[model samples]
Target: MASSDLVRRIVLLVVLCVSGGAMAQTGQDTSLVERGRYLATAADCVACHTTDPAKPFAGGVSIPTPFGQIVAPNITPDPDTGIGKWTDEEFYRAMHEGVGRNGENLYPAFPYDAFTKLSREDVLAIKAYLFSLPAMSQDNPVSELGFPFNQRWILSGWKLLNLRKGEMKPEPAQDDAWNRGAYLVEALAHCGTCHTPRDFSMGSDESRKFGGGAVGSWQAYNITPDPVSGIGDWSDDELVEYMRTGMVAGKGGAAGGMGEAVEHSLSKLPEQDLRDIVTYLRAQKPVRDPADEKPRHGWGAPSEDVSAFRGDETGDDPDGRAIFYGACSSCHGMAGAGTDDGEFPPLFRNTVVGARQANNLVMAILEGVHRTVDGETVSMEAFEHKLTSAEVAAVSNYVLKTYGNPAGATVDAAMVDELRRNAGEQPLVAKLAMPGLIIGVIVILALVFWLLTRRRRRSLR
Candidate 1:
């Protein structure tokens, strides 16, 4: 061959080699799809995507972010409404590069940063499971973001600063179980999406990995191995039970977002996987000591603060008596003998009063309870509305102090404000009457107008 021809042939050979390797890396098969299914579950994809059972993978689950509400997109195999038409390469690009099928950058709400740790093979597995799901032709409206956040181009700049592109690499020093747990927790599970704190710019602060996070309406507590502020004191079994059933022995049961996670994802996981998670958590680095951290003045105490709130106020105990008579006595009974069949269970006998930590009572009181009644969730109606923060605090303090357990924490007014803020109650409640009431009235007026018009037409005939 001539020199030019030989050079061209060599270049062609190199191109083929690179292209072949790329194809091998992105290849999709049955096994890969199955792996993806497992990964998606581990990542809690269903918790957000398949929120409404009737609308599985159809997407309309609104996730509250500081910027605005973000809705997870349909990833099912629907050509028009889902990712049915997306090429394998396109899928890879989205998972690895954080770019959409058409090259638009996806918002970090999808947690591609942590997902970026997943191998191409792992991401492909997730894609397979999503595609295998029954596709629905639902078109969820895009979020109504305010100001600069609505711009898609801004995410490109976000990528430049925060996105670190790579795959998971195991720590060789760790055992196989620990390594597996680490990969699942840090990458597939994307636990950091909720647990890790974010900076002002809206990216997770790696320095505080597994530290507490305050998203729009929910607070994801720190799960670091910290003895106080984190899960340092929890045993392996406690961790497993918490993950599997959303209940820990002394720490209280899961509620809110955590409850949902347990119901959808964790509950279905194999026992071994739960054990691995516990092992991994136990081995994690402690973020902070609870004692060293500043004490939160208001919220229900974790146990130690009970005495300060109690004092030598036997006379005030009757005030506690009156409050209980007014509110709790109906269900719990005046003598604190819990109701039969564990329904309206006694205050003295209940786990909340007996818990080593006070989070259960604090959360239950602040958020309130709802037992399933006649196929519908019957809410007991939270006193959060009727009772003052101080009143609620005082009542809770009184219950723990007098009835069955030691005194409750020093949950003052300021603590109430903080909890209310964290729950996103104040903002939503303030606007509830404004829009709903007005809309209801308008709907009634429109119906009346239609009825009047129909009557006039009949009379004319």
Candidate 2:
């Protein structure tokens, strides 16, 4: 019980207490950053912002719109080109108000309208994670929109009609899980941006929410709860599986934009979140387009004609059956049935083949699929150069009639040729020509006004 011993023990206890406090603070900081990372993943910011695999978030992705192509800008911590110089307030305004650092309106292609529903804390967390990344000095390409479409002011008008600013309030009737799913799907995921048809001003058509819309050549299929046209028949498990792996046996696989979403975003999400998305989707009001009488995979029965394997070639033009034997029979069987393992899905009861529009099927034939699920690489070779447009049309027709909806058998060589020529091109509105005409008329009016003023001055003199 010496006085010296008591003093030494007291000093040691004080030192330990300070060290423990410091460690706890460090842990909190790490947790915040990790939370931010998870939020960014849920938001799927990397899909649009990161064009190159090597340069993640150093954005240069080309998003095509009816107006033109708008390249995504860098979001890296680079002070000059990226948002490194952005204040927290500036970043919030951009996300919540769809305004830039200089107070300019951002194109809806950025999906800020949906992002506006994000809470301030969530938006800041995303910013925090983005700032933590390595800065790249890459400058994004300028947008190629013509005339009035290129004008940023036009977006102000568009926003007044479409943009709904404010965080989503939970519905009193719904449970916490349902509300969470709704927020994630409608706000963060912005599924309506693609699935909902556009109005005259290019805003999403709320009346047909998740009832399907066209994105370039690809159709974002109806996801409403309609038994025939939408996903009402899809089991919860099937929906979750499709979101996770981008495929469901006897149904279909993802391609194009949906394919990209699966590869980059959906596949990377947690299983629970995927289930939540399905929950929200299932609760949607059933909407059916009159054109769709049944589910996409519920059409035509499989056919097995022996003439196809015999190379009969009886038709005036080369039949699709003969072409299938020569080119496609190797991977896909003579009967159009794929591998037993479901690595290559069977042609019958396939989503893509049975879709109301044959655009996806045609494009798949021309471009082919090359996506990786889990660790395995799933690929289908492109036949654009190998097969003539006529041959493609014939084979596509045969597959549609034999293994899919006969109504979808309307594709011709001319349609194939046009699809080939405009392969990677954006869908431009026919009204693009009208913009140039308007500008010309305005210029002529200005000149006429000037001439009249000059004549008046001369008369006065």
Candidate 3:
């Protein structure tokens, strides 16, 4: 071949190799972004960050806290209103140290204490996935917090008390699956943020890990292996099925935060990952409360009140049995034995009904069950508008007596009224905050009145 022809051939080979290398790099980037998206789902990031399904991660969701409502910040790639300008280092810091890009302290509500355990690579992968999304430019509203909480500077002191910054280390004795489960549970899932109770300063009580905590308007049930109060008797399959679909035959259903986690996160996760989580939970130290009773799913039998509905259709008296015939009987059956396939789960042997605390059950009645698994949405219509509070209480008591834990059958209209306030109480901080604010206002008015009198006397002179 001529020298020019040989040179042309060599140049063509170099161009093809370069093209192949670029294509390989793009493939890797796509894979990383996909992995990050999975991790984001596992983290249930959408639960707090996105209010509207159409504009995910744009972060205008309002999270109710004892202090006040905490608004989720935008994590989308909008340079103006989102974290688009954030460097990988800044993102990692937010995850690992509970610190924001501008070095502001993030509230514990974000659960950075758990994110702190995530590996640097995992954190960056999550960031990569977040950045890959369409840059949403919606502005996040300021968190509606009370005095001390609104003062971001106070959060620094909170961090010192609660934050534990570091990556999770694998336990050598455990097998790979167990270790994987541990990582997913302790870090990515951040289950402790909901399962573990908070201390006085509102930090998760690590000592009481998985002992069950309260979320907005719902109780995060005890997941510890205690036989009475927790899931000790729950078989691995039961736990897995419940986590995967928010429903397991004769066990319980997930509602509130748990329902969201199931629909958006757990149900979509790889099966092995879920099995690993169950393994880790099983291995944790069992925690039991002194007031513990039988397992939540171990309560009740078929309602004998079946006889009440058997008679002539009762007059429009809105008592528990009357309401059950009218509203509940169509799905749950007259015997309270739910549908054959467990589509409509039996109120008996169910957590919401059998739980010692009536909060979750009442909330469910008012708000109703809504969870999606495998792209199918399962929902129960909410009765907040349809039923009076007294009617809710009556039906709740009847369900508890006939089909659930008789111990928890003590619900009343007054208790239902309280639960109607969205299932949470004012935090100690907010409870104290309002009174202190009132006192401060009174003192300021007194000072102003004294000053006005002094000015009047001077004018008279």
lDDT, each prediction:
0.68, 0.83, 0.87
lDDT of 2 by residue, 262-322 (tens): 8877888888888888888888888887987778899766567777766654557868888
Better of 2 and 3 by TM-score: 3
**lDDT per residue (tens digit) for residues 135-242 in model 1:** 788888787555456778978877887889989898899998998888878887788888887764567778888877655445567788876567776677877877
Model 1 is weakest, by summed lDDT over 10 consecutive residues, at 295-304
| lDDT for 31 (candidate 3) | 90
TM-score of each: 0.67, 0.88, 0.90
Model 3 local distance difference test score? 0.87
- Model 1 has a clash total of 6
Worst 10 residues of 2 by lDDT: 421-430
**How much is the lDDT of residue 244 in candidate 3?**
90
Candidate 1 TM-score, true structure as reference: 0.67
Give the alpha carbon lDDT tens digit for every residue of 261-340 in model 3.
99999998998999999999999999898876678888888874656555435555357877887888888888888899
